[model samples]
Target: MQPTESKGLSSSIFISRCRAVWIHIGEMSCSSYKVKRISGFDPPPARVFAWRVLELKEQGVREDDAMAVADMEYRTQKKAKKKAYKELKEIARSEGKKPPPNPYPSAIKEIQAEEKKYVMDRLFNPKVIEIANKMKEERDKLRQDRAADGL
Candidate 1:
């Protein structure tokens, strides 16, 4: 394991050449290294899901389709349960059993709903109405101030 002397080439060039290739006397260089293949691989669930969504998009699927696919099973189960409940209600009615009261909102909620609608109308209607109301209030205040000053 003696350091080789640089006879002709520059020191940097000799080192670079040695680093790039091994000089062997009628034998293969670096024979002690062996290559092996890896196996037994599995990806995480979130990565798999992201790849699946991207695949769907690449195949020209709508994003909504991919977004809704995750919740489709739950939605189908909910719909099936509602249908079963409706059928049971119909069967009970056929046996002359008194059905439950209508599930509509009560009078109190209806009154509150109307009040909410009025307030929302006043707040979020076209700017014309809001500007008119603001102008009317300012004019009334001005008139009151003038009356107080004159008195």
Candidate 2:
């Protein structure tokens, strides 16, 4: 049977095979197979956490203390959301209809899973901290260069 006609062949496996065939025929560049990096945009929860930590740091809080406060604030916000959803669920049940699905827990789990993939929790990952510092330095250097050029 032809590879493309094979039953239950996963898309990724099929694509890889096609790519290999194309490369052998000199029809595709190896450069096209390079993985693209994720963009610099932060997710909402991450942005909020970073802002809170930065605000605390600007107010003279130590790095560890700032991160702790930010972490607590994030947890508190999540807890409040879960509590609100529970209240809504109870109200729906009282009116004799099936309670609506509670989305907060699932959404939080998804966000946490995504964060885990990126090692985004700086408090737990020293590598993230180093990357953040390097990014900050690059930003600051760019600003200085722009100022010197009268831009």
Candidate 3:
């Protein structure tokens, strides 16, 4: 690894050196060695958690409360779907028509619904995702500005 000029990536990056200038900052490079020299957390997990907790607290709800609300909504939707399906069955019986497929495939769909709830809670319960999205947009804007300025 030839020296760009003075500083190069840290030891962590030099452990596995690839010979291609993937980037150019100053003498910019993709060498992980200089990763510490880079600013900002690549991705912050604890920050996300803290943001989520703060967001929920501001909204006057705990995580369990949010999960309960989700479950209740799920149940309400299930009940409504069941009612509609039953009503369709009544109409079919009176009209001597074949009943449509069970609109409420709860038995089969329950797992999927549960899985969706799990994912939503795990990934989106807190406002961390929203915060992350906004941060990404801001960072992208900053990069664009820097690029425009020939930085």
Candidate 4:
């Protein structure tokens, strides 16, 4: 083996040396690094617990009550949501009934209509029309000036 140098080597040299040692060990190991699958239809243990909490929720258990039983983090509450939604969809499918249309559709339509009305008002109202006409005249003058300047 080479003696350790007193001076530090460049990062690339250090990385290469570490990689060489790692590779040598990896070759002798039974297994190299293997990536485990993290997500699937098969629920993890945490998901199972979260699903139970969701069941309690469906049975009218309050959020505080469910959290007391589940001992999950705030983020893990999302898994309970996923579980609830999945069960809802499944029950709807199994019952041979079309799932109810999203209750917020009219609210969405109202919002879209409001946005369109606002845009139309901005584009065509008296004050807006006057401003738009002024801008058009300014643009025409600029275009004419540019043409005269051969620009």
Each model's TM-score?
A: 0.25, 0.41, 0.33, 0.31
| Stretches > 4 Å off in candidate 2 | 1-43, 105-151
**Candidate 1 lowest-lDDT run of ten:** 10-19
Task: Put down candidate 3 lDDT per residue, 2-82, tens digits, no spaces.
Answer: 445546532111211221112122434333222132356442323333333334434667656644554455468668988
Clashes of each: 0, 0, 7, 0
> lDDT (CA) for every model shown?
0.51, 0.60, 0.54, 0.54
Better lDDT candidate (2, 4): 2
C-alpha displacement of 94 in model 1, angstroms?
A: 0.5
Comparing 2 and 3 on lDDT, the stronger one: 2
Find the candidate with the highest TM-score and give its number.
2
Q: lDDT: which candidate is best? A: 2
For 1-151, candidate 1 gives per-residue lDDT tens digits of 2232443322111112111212221222222222222466554333334344434544566656753552454357557866776776788799999765443336698799779977887778897587878999999999999999999
Clashing pairs in 1: none
Q: Predicted candidate 3: what Cα RMSD to the true structure?
A: 26.6
Instruction: Please say which candidate is ahead in TM-score: 1 or 2.
Output: 2
Candidate 3 clashing pairs, residues 3+ apart or interchain: 9-33, 9-34, 10-33, 10-34, 13-33, 24-28, 25-28
TM-score of 1: 0.25
The segments of candidate 3 whose C-alpha lies over 4 angstroms from its true place after superposition are 1-58, 106-151
Over 4 Å off in model 4, which ranges? Answer: 1-102, 106-110
Query: For model 3, what is the alpha-carbon lDDT of residue 140?
Result: 100
